[model samples]
Target: MKPKVIGKCIIEKEEFPDGRIRIKRTTEGITAFELYWHLEQAQEEISKQLMGLLKPDIIKRR
Candidate 1:
């Protein structure tokens, strides 16, 4: 479910029978170096596996 779009950020949530994916995104504001840092260390499937193995609150802390 997409709650709303504020400025460059889109706050949304995705739910499934067993789990979900909550995401916060921004189309602008970050610098190029920040983008590179995120892209370099990000895990694309970590969310899916995380939902399978852990809980949302754990992710919220990181």
Candidate 2:
């Protein structure tokens, strides 16, 4: 299935035939395309970036 927005992040889930499941979560942020439409006839290139708020949290799955 395709990823969908759940809360702040985009989440996707997949199930394997071997009884294993895969889950992924990605940050939903602004894209470069959005800048073009809003800016309209911009001078130079525009970009948006995201940075970690704090220390990264590592998750270990069994």
Candidate 3:
């Protein structure tokens, strides 16, 4: 299925024949963003990327 827009976010989900499910979530705005899942291993990366996009100046404060 195609991605669906909900509020300011776009969400999509797919299931593989092998029983693996993938999900993608992102926001619609000036800067494009995306998140992917392949049975874990990139959660931290996604979180960091989201924080950077949501608050670019946050890192400078630390």
Best by lDDT: 3
The deviation in Å at residue 31 for candidate 2 is 11
lDDT-based ranking = 3, 1, 2
Model 3 scores a C-alpha lDDT of 0.66
The residue-by-residue lDDT of candidate 2 on 1-62, one tens digit each, is: 54443336778999999999999978765555665555764433332211232224322231
RMSD of 3: 16.3
Superposition error at 22 for model 1 (Å):
37
Candidate number that wins on lDDT, 1 or 2? 1
Higher-scoring candidate on lDDT, 1 or 3: 3
Model 3 misplaced regions, further than 4 Å: 1-7, 31-62
Question: Where does model 2 exceed 4 Å of error?
Answer: 1-7, 30-62
Q: Give the per-residue lDDT digits (tens) of candidate 3, residues 1-62.
A: 54643347778998999999999988874321233333244877788888879795876688
* lDDT score at residue 25, model 3, on the 0-100 scale: 89
The TM-scores of all predictions, comma-separated, are 0.25, 0.34, 0.34
lDDT of all predictions: 0.63, 0.55, 0.66
Mark the regions of model 1 whose C-alpha exceeds 4 Å error after superposition: 1-28, 43-62
